[model samples]
Every structure is written in structure tokens, then in C-alpha cells.
Target: MLTIKGKLGIEDFYRIIFKEEAILINKDVLTTVENSFNFLSQFSQNKIIYGVNTGFGPMAQYKINDSDRIQLQYNLIRSHASGTGNLIPEQYVKAAMLARLNTLSLGHSGVHISVIELMTSLINKNITPVIFEHGGVGASGDLVQLAHIALVLIGEGEVFYKGERRPTEEVFKLENLKPITITLREGLALINGTSVMTGIGLINTINTRKLLDWMICCSSAINEIVQAYDDHLSLELNQSKKHKGQQQIAKSMRHHLKDSTLTRKREHHLYNGNNEVTIFEEKVQEYYSLRCVPQILGPVLDTLNNVEKILIEEVNSANDNPIVDVEKEHVYHGGNFHGDYVSLEMDKLKLIVTKMSMLAERQLNYLLNPNLNNILPPFVNLGTLGLNFGMQGVQFTATSTTAENQMLSNPMYVHSIPNNNDNQDIVSMGTNAANITKKVIENTFEVLAIETITIVQAIEYLKVQDKISSKTKKMYDDIRNLVPPISDKDVPMYPYVNKVKNFILNFEEEIYACKELN
Candidate 1:
């Protein structure tokens, strides 16, 4: 079990989200939370505190009475729990809950300690709040999606407990859990932040790391299949470009093709030959997709590194309104609830991942076209050319899915629509950005899986698997284990394609041996 203290780091997220480790809150954090609540209890006694003594958003013109103060929080939570569309998957919800818990642990949100305790229990029990994919403008920071979380905190709404959607009350009762009482500002504090988007973005970034490694492997494998010159990935060539991502990508490619017998050295193949033929058969340079893996995926790596940094800062921040300061003994109101940070990062991430998918599609095309790769049969079909279909049908799936990723890469950050009586004008559509990014990411995985299968088929037709690098051979063996080389005949391909997708999704290994994420 992992213990969350004052701050949360990226490693903490890896432990809880990926390693399936349960978490505990430090006692000092609970003390800090109680102190903040006490300070707010006295500080807001006569002053007008937003979302506490006054109505929320455009309704702040009206003041709430003392008798209705506690009920006000419940009203906000229940009313805003109006999110619609498909339910977000359980893993993302858990990450969001972790994000919210980490922020509240900072003690600036003025939430009661019961709030922290209840969230800890929910997370440890693997009981996730049922959140939807829509109804958030991200101006007030995932208002609708987080309200579902607030609703569950008060023992209302629904939760996915033990692999099923059940009433929050039923799960709480089964687990002997007690709901948090509305003390001061738990409702507004819980819902008013970028936790939802941060959570989803965190999960996306983690999976993106996996996708990138696999894409790099596929890129290196394709170069080996075509017997491309190794100078394109030479240390002298890529390092001179002055990009860390480029140098690192070239480094990884060198490792992958280290034992490859197919990739030829330009000095050995071209320089040694003194033939005076005007038009030699071998092409000088490969297509950009195979040769420029470093130049293309370099920006992808740099962007991913930046995205991870910004998200870590976001999760550890005090992102709620009316931040209560026990040390200053004051309540300060501001717009820390805005989600522009998460929104912008998600958009950038979506755009880069789409670019990766496009690269994969182009590489897959080069493998299928007989003219581009004179090494393999057309479509790598070992059967009668026209009578039996080979990988031709499956290539369509890769092409269409890549087109969808391109379409989905349009930025959601610049497409905000004002709501909340224009009080939330100039909003951030962060949740939508994150959701759409998730779709693009999953689609890219499918596209890469198709590309991976095609690369293996080319290797099989060449019958030079014995000469391939150890890395490429492992990939070939893993894929061939799922389904044999699609030669002599083609079986039903949809299930086979999905099987590869699932393999990509579930497969975990350390491919970034030369470089580790910072």
C-alpha cells in the first residue's frame, strides 16, 4: 500500500494507477485539512465567501442564510450531477479520485477531514464514482463530471464497486463506510478543479508511453525488413541535429537493429561497388516514413515529456476557489478552478499522437505496396494472387482508423462555448478534449496493431527471420504466437485484428532501455 502525504508525484500515480497499489493518507495532511476548515469556519462568519455564503456563478448576487449553509453544498452537488453520455471507464475515474484527493490533502480547499477519509476509503476499496463523458465546459473545471464524485461522497448517486455498478449507499453499507457530512465547502471544493481532466490525461500519458515504445519498435523493424541503409540512424547523423528526442530515437533504433543482418551499411553496399552502371538497382535512400523515424517521433517524445511535467504540477496544486489559508488566517477567492492548463496539454497530446498514427499508416502502406518494397509479395500474399485475399482487407481498417484519428486531432481548447449566464465566459473545454484524446489514442493503438501485423508478415515472406535483430525477432515470435503468418490462405481477420489490438493494449515490457522517462 502506498501512503499519500502532503504532495503527490508521478511515481505515486504509477503506483496507484498502474501497479494496483492501495493508498493511505498521512495523518499530518488530515491535521492540515482540519486546521483549514477551522480557519474558514471563523473567517467566513461575517464575510461573503463565494460558493459558501453566496450563491454560485451568476447567482452570487443572492446571499445564502446560515440555516441553509450546509444544505447549500448538497444542493450544488445534486443539481450539478447532470452529466450525460457514456460512463468513463473505471481506471480513469480512479485516477481522477486520486487527483482530487491529492489536491484536497494540500489543505487549501477548507474541506473537513471526513471528506479526506471518505475519499481514501473509496479509493482503497476500489469503489469508483460513476462519471459521464459530457456536460463539462471546463471553465469551472469539470463541473458536471466531478459532481458525480461529490454526489458519491454524500452517499448518493452510483459507484462501480467490485466490478459492478451499484448504488453508492449500498456499496458504502456493504463496506461499513460512512458518508462525509457537509461541514463547510466540501461540495464546491470537490467539484471545482481540473481533477477530472488531470486524471484522464494522466492515464492517457501513461498509455501513450507504451504506444510510443511500440511505434519505435515497429519503425526499427520496418527498416530491417526493407534492408535500408544504417547511416540514416547513425549516431553522427542524428546527434548533429541537436534534438534530445531525435538522438534518443536514433539510439533506440540502433539498439533494435544492432544484430540485424538485413540492414546494409552504406559504405559496404554502395561505396565498395565500383560499377560504372548509370542506374544501379538499389534505391539510395528509403521513404521518409522508415528513414525519418527519429525526425518525426522526436517532437512526439518532447511533447510527451512536457505534458507529463504540466500534469504533475496540476495534480499537486491547490486548484479550488476561495483557498482557505490557516497560516494567514484569511479566505482568498480566485479562479484556480479554471482548466486551461489541462485543456491545452490534452490538445497538444491529441495532435502529436495523431501524427504518430499517420506515420504508422504510411509505413503500413509501404509494406503492402509491391512497388515500394520489392522484397515481399503483393500484400505479402503467399496464396494465388487474385483468387485469395491476403492482408489487403485488413489494411483498410488501418487506413480508416488513421483517418478518424486525424479528424479527431482538431483542437478542443480553441472551440469553447460560454455558459453559466456568461459568468464562465472564455471557458476551457478540457473534459471534452481529454475524452476525444482518449478515443484518438485507442484508435491509434488499433492502427499501430495493424501495422505491427503487416511488418511481421513481411518478415515471414522474406524467410530471413533468422537474420533479424533479437528485438525484431521477439516481436515476430510474439505476434506469430497469436496468429501464424497469413500466407497460403487468409482466415477471418477481424477477430485476429482485435486480438492484436488487445495484445498491444495489455502487453508490457521495457523497450526504452537506452532512455528512461524523467
Candidate 2:
């Protein structure tokens, strides 16, 4: 079961979202909810609350008559379900639902218990709402996109039932479920927050963190192949710089390369005494990718770690305006609903992904360039240069993908256009940042895929005299199965590229299982 203490951190949400079982718990939410309810009863006796007793945004000043207040919540949800674009993937929709639930659990929104129970039911039964990926400004709190989620709760929108899209009413009827009736501040609470942006950002953070680990692993693989100097990764050297990420990276690389026989042997002479000892002739220092691995990627890790901290806090927060502070006996209007915090973090993460993509692109270039590649054949071709076109096209693909990532990394937070008639003058656009960050991370995956394939081919060409490291050998065989060795007549390489990406996307466990066998 996924657990939420009042302090919801990014790492926690990430684990819960990725786990297929889909159970979640917010232990402190009930208390927060009670606090909100008490405040509403004591302080909201006569005044019109923006969402609870009056209209939403552009029309907030309009008064909601007592007779129409409850119906207003339902109308608000049904009307706001105007999303029209590509459906958000089931995984992301599920994540949004979870984020919404955690937000409600904070108890400042005055949502009914039945509403929370309904959301929990959808998660437990795997009843996913159909939501689109567009139309959120991240200022009015992902309003339109989240409305789709709210519609499912009230049996008015479409839902994925038994792997097929069906009307929420039918799905609820079939499951003997009833639509949750909105009461008091329920409707406003449901849609007025940053769940959509948070969901995308959380998911991106999860994948990006793992990708960073793999980049380090790949760097270690390169070190083993080149027999590069270990002095660059020394803890003392990284510690003096005081970068936690660099230190952590150095530790991971050292651990991964610790037992490899392919690395430089300090003894200088062969164990059998067959070869004479000689001073090294190659440059003492390696290329940037090899020597600067920790330096370049460490800051990225630190940034991601900080983003995770912010996400967890945001996910657990009560972000709706006019929060009910029961202890204070007041419904306080505030800007807790703003997504500025998430927008900032998401931008930072995008920059981190850009750096990682650039680094991966550089490493792939090194493997393909004959001079810089340390005696590897041009493009690591299996035969004579022209006889096989080799990894030339694949390298081009990497370069293009990295360039695209750099383009997408332009911060979305910096390009704010006022909306809602300038009432929302300074917006977050965090949803845009989250969506673009996801694409950037996806692009990074493709670049890494290209790098992985290139390294596999290079290793195949090497046929190393000493046994290749067991970990690397397993990775080599795995890629070979997905994309068999390229021959002169292999013609186009897209199929091979697609297959490699599929392996990364769908068979992650199998990939890790192979790693374990090593």
C-alpha cells in the first residue's frame, strides 16, 4: 500500500505511482479535512466563498444563491470537462488521480468523505478516468484536465473499464458504485490544484533519476574498455570540490569498476611474465566523457534530488484557494493553489536532462570517432569502411535527438503570458514544463539507446583479449538479441532502433534481471 504522511515527498509518490498494485494511504489528511470543515462552519456563515458560494475565476464576483450552490459544484465539474486532445496515458491519469486524492486528504478543501472514498475506489478497482494532455495553464490549477478526473468521480465522463473506454455511469453501475455528490467546497477542491503538473513532473523525475544511474553505469563501462585512470574518480578529489552528486557518482563508478580485469593493472607486467613492462605512450588524461563523467553529471543529480524534495511537499499540500483552517475558525483566501514552486523545479529538471543528453551524445560521438575512439575502427564497422556503412547513421540519429532535447530544455516558466483577463498575471505554466520535461527525458532515453547499441557493436569488434566484464558481456548479448549485429546489407536501421527502445520501455525488469545474472 502507498502511504502518505502529511509530508509527501517526491520519492514516495514516484514509488506509489510506478507500483501496479495501486493502493494509497494519507494518514494525516482526515485531520486536515476536519480542520477545514470546522473553519467553514464557524467562519463562512454569511460571506460568499469564491468557489464554494460564488462562481469560478473570470466570474468569481457573481454570487451563488443558497438554492444553487450544491448544483453549482456539479455544473462546474460537468462544464469544465471540456478537455479535447490526446488522452493522457493510463499511467499518468492514474497518477493524477492519486495526486488529487492526496491533495484532498489535506482537509483544507471541505470535500465530503464520500468523494475521497470514490477516488480510493477507482484506484483500488483500477477504474481509470480518461483525461487529455492539454488545456491546463498551471495557474488556475490544471482546471480543465482535472475536471475530466472529477467527472469520472461523479459518473459523468468516460473511464477505462476492463481495458476498454466506457461511460463512467455504466462502469459505476456495473461495479455497483454511485457517483459522489458534491457538497460545500467539494467541487472547488477537486479541480482547483496542480495535480496534473505534479503527476507529469513526478513521473519524469522517476524515469530521469533511473536514467542518470544508467548514464553512470555506461560511463563505468567505457572506463573499463579504455583502461582509463582512476585518479579522476578518487573520493578525496571529488570531496574537495564539495559536490554531493559528484561524490556519489564517483562512489558508484568506483564500485562498478572495482572488480573488472579489463581496467588498468598496477602490476604493469603480465601475471605469466610473458610481456615486458613499458611506460604508457598514450595521453595520461582521457577525453571529457571519461574524465569528466562525475563533474558534468553530478550537478544534475543534485538538482533532481532537490526537485524530488519539492514535489513531495507539493503533492501533500492543500493547494486550493479559500482554505478552511478549522483551528483558526476561518476560511482564508490565499495563493496556496499557485504552481510556481513546481514550475521552478520542473524547469531545473529539464535543464538537468539536457545536460545528461548532451553528455550521452558526446560519449556516443567518442565511440564512433576513429581518432578519439582509441583504435576502434571508424564507426566501429565490422569490415572495411565502405563495405559497411556502419554506425554512421546511428550516430547521426543521436546527434539529432540531443539537439532536439536542447531545444525543448528552454524553460517554460520564463515564458509566461497573462491570462484570465490578466487576473492571473503571473502564471506557472508548470504543466507545459512537465510535459516538455517528459519529452526531453524520452529523448534522452533514445540517445542512451543509440549509445548502448554503439558500445555493444564496438565491444563486438574489440573481441577483447582479456575477458570483458561479466556485466558488460551480458548487456552485449541482450542488445545483440534485440538488434542483431548489423551487416553490410542491413540497409535501414530504424527497425533496430525501434526494437532497442522497445526493450528499454517494455522489458525493464528483464534488462535488470540480466544485470543481476552478471
Candidate 3:
């Protein structure tokens, strides 16, 4: 079980949502939450508290009567539950809920302890609220999307229970769960935060790191298959530049390529005769895809590291507006709800991932073309060259996918538009950026899948299976276990490609378990 004590780390977030760990609020944190609520109760009925006594947004000037205050909070949730487009995945909804619960547990949101318990109960019971992909300007804290989730808490919206969608009220009654009563500032506290964006960003960062590792591993395998020189990844060259990512990538490549008979020094490939010197060698160096793997992918690793740090801080932050301070007995209104930090980091991640895709595509091109490939058959066709169109069409698919990723890489942070009746003018499009980054990740995975398949095929054609590194050999055999090696006949490659893509998606955990890779 995972305990939420007003703070959540990125790795713990993944384990809670993906690993299905139960959650509990710390006792001390629960005390803080009750104290804040008690303090807020001391405020006068006529006090003009934002989202409590007064209306929200542009309507903040209008005050509600004491009898209608609770009703006002209920109406706010129902009205703001206006999310559109496709529903967010259950994993993301659970993550967002956990994030919101952690923020509210800080005792700054003025939410009742029951609200926190109910949210934890929903997660522990695997009940996920239906949140939409669209609807959120990323300002005023993912209002519509989170409001849809808030509606489920009050037994008024939809939820996915036991892998089936059901009405929230029906599930609550069946599960013996009671609907939460909205108190002063409870509804606002639920919706006024950056949980949605931060949740998506956190998961995306984790997946991106996995993809980077696979890319480096595949690049090393391709380097051996192409018989590229290993000097480019030498530690001396990398240490001279003094970039941490560059040095780390070079070290990882060397480790992956360790004890390989296929990799050769430049001198080993050169011929030195007793007579007049007549040099005989393949190219002096390799193309940028093989030669500059560390240089191109190093910066991407750096960018992802920086993005993960920012997201961790965002997840643990008190981003709610009108922060309740029980210690000072004051309510502070601030703009911590804005998602600019997450938006900008996601934009940067998108751009770097596109670059990674480009590098993968270039390596695929090198393996497909007969002239570029080290005397390999055209399109890696092992059978009759003209009849078998081995990987020709698949290479085209990779190119198109990489092109799509390039277009999606355009920065989304620069394209903010004024919204919310001009009252929320200059909105942050953080959610939009995060959603597109996910698409980019999906596309890049397919691209890497194509490269993985092609690299294995190239190795088969060269008959260098025994000469490759042990790590590369293990990776090759693992892939061939799932996807049979291409024989002397043509076969549809989509199934094989998809199998490899799924394999890559889960490969990170496998690596973590392997003592050799560690």
C-alpha cells in the first residue's frame, strides 16, 4: 500500500496508478486538513471568500445566501462538468485523482477529511471517473475536466467499475459508499489545481525515459550490424566535451557493446602491407545515425531529466487557489493554478522526442538501402530480390510516421489563445500540449519498432549472430521469440511490428529486473 502524506514522488505515482497499490492518508496530514476546515468555518457568513461565499470567475462579485451556499458549490460542479471529446484513459483518471488527493492532503485546499477518504476509497476500489481529453484551457486549473471527476465524487456522474462503465450513484450504492456533501470551498479545492496536466506529464516522462533506453540499445545493435567503428563512442572523446548526458550516453553504449566480436577498431579494419602502402578500408567513419548516437540522443536524455524534476515538484505542490492557511488563519489568493511550468516542459519534451524519432528513422534508412547497407540485399530481401519487397513498404511507413511526429513537435506553448469571456485571457494550453506529446510518443514507438525489426533482419542477413554483443544477442533472441524471423517468403509485417512495439513498451521493466543491465 502507498501512503499519501501531502507529497507524491513521480515513481511512487506510477506504482500507485499502474501497479494498483492501495492508498491511505497520513494521520498528521488528516489533522492538518481538519484544522484548515475548522479555521475556514470561523469566517463570517458575510465574508466574501472566493468560490465559497462568492461566485466563481467573472461572477465572483455575486454573493450567495447562507442557506444556498452548499447548493452553490453543488451547482458549480454540475455546471463546470462540461468536458467534451473522447474520455481520458482510466489510468490517467486514476493518476489525476491521486494527484488531486495529495494536494488536498496538504490541508491548504480546505476540503473535508471525508472528501479525501472518499477519493482514496474510489482509487482503492478501482473506480475511475470519466474525464474528457478535451476541455481545459490549463488555466484556472483544468476546471471542466476535473469537475467531471468531482461530479463522480458526489454520486452524480459516470464511473468505470470492474472494467464496465456505470452510473456513479449505482456504483456507490452497490459498493456501500456514500456520496460526499460539499462544504465551503470543497468543490473549488477539488477543481482548482493542476492535477490533470501534472498527472499526464508524469506518466509521459516515465515512458519517455524507457523509450530513450530502448533507442540507445537498438542503436548499439545497429552499430554492430553495420560494422561501424567504435571509436566515435570512446570515453576520451565524450569526456573532453564535459556534457553529463553525453558522457553518460557514451558510457551506456560502451556497456551495451561490451565483449562484442562484431565491433572493430579503425586500425583493425585498415590493411597495412609490407610493400608500398595501399590502404583498404570500408568508410573511414559511419553516418551520423551510427557515428553520432551519443551526440544526438544525449541532449534528449538531459531534457527528459530536467522535465521529470519539474513535474515532481508540480505533483507535490499546493497549486490550489485561495490557499487556506490554518497556521496564520488567513486565505491567500494566488495564481499557482497556472500550468505554464508543465506546458513549457512538455513542449520541450515533444521537440526532443521528434529528434529521437528522426535519428531512429535515419538508422532504418541505412539498413534498408543496399548501397548504404554493408553489401546487404536490397530491402533486406533474403529471397528473390525483386519479388519479395521485404521491408520496402515498412520503411515508407516509418518515414511517414517520423514526418507526422515532426509536425506535431511544433511548440504548443507559443500558441495560447485568450479564453473564458476574456476574463481568463492568455490561457495556458498545457493539456493540449500533453495530449499531443503522447501521440508523438506513440508514433515514435512505432518508428523504433520498425528499426528493431530491420536491425534483427540485417543481422540475420549478415549471419553475424554469434559475433554480436551478449546484450544484443539476448535482445535479438527475445524479439525473435515473439516475432519469428523473416524467412525466404513474404509475410504481412504489421502483426510482427505491433508485437515488437508492445514488447518495447514493457521492456523497461524487464531491464530493471535484469542484473546485467543494472
Q: Candidates sorted by TM-score, descending order?
A: 1, 3, 2
lDDT (Cα atoms) of all candidates against the true structure = 0.89, 0.79, 0.85
Clashes of 2: 7
Off by over 4 Å in 1: 273-275, 512-518
Error of 3 at 509 (Å): 3.6
Which residue pairs show collisions in model 3? none
Candidate 1 minimal-lDDT segment of 10 residues: 509-518
TM-score of each: 0.98, 0.91, 0.96
lDDT (tens digit, per residue) of candidate 2 on 258-350? 767777743363334644547645755789988998898888888988898788788888887877766656677878878888998999998
Q: List the residue pairs that clash in candidate 1.
A: none
Best by TM-score: 1
lDDT of 3 by residue, 1-518 (tens): 87788878876887897688898788998899898888888863557788888888888878888888899888889999998898888987888888888888888888878898899899999999998988888988889888998999898899999999999999999999987767787788888888998888887887788788888888999888777789899998999987788778888889888878878887664544335547634677788889998898889988999999998898888998898888887889878899899899999999988999999999899888878866688888777877778788899899999999999999878788887777788767888888889889989999999988888888888899999988888888888887776767788899988999988886644441122211
Tens-digit lDDT track of model 1 for 428-483: 89999999999999999999888988888888888888999999999899899987
Clashing residue pairs found in predicted model 2: 8-312, 9-312, 10-312, 29-105, 32-107, 33-107, 35-326
Model 3 TM: 0.96
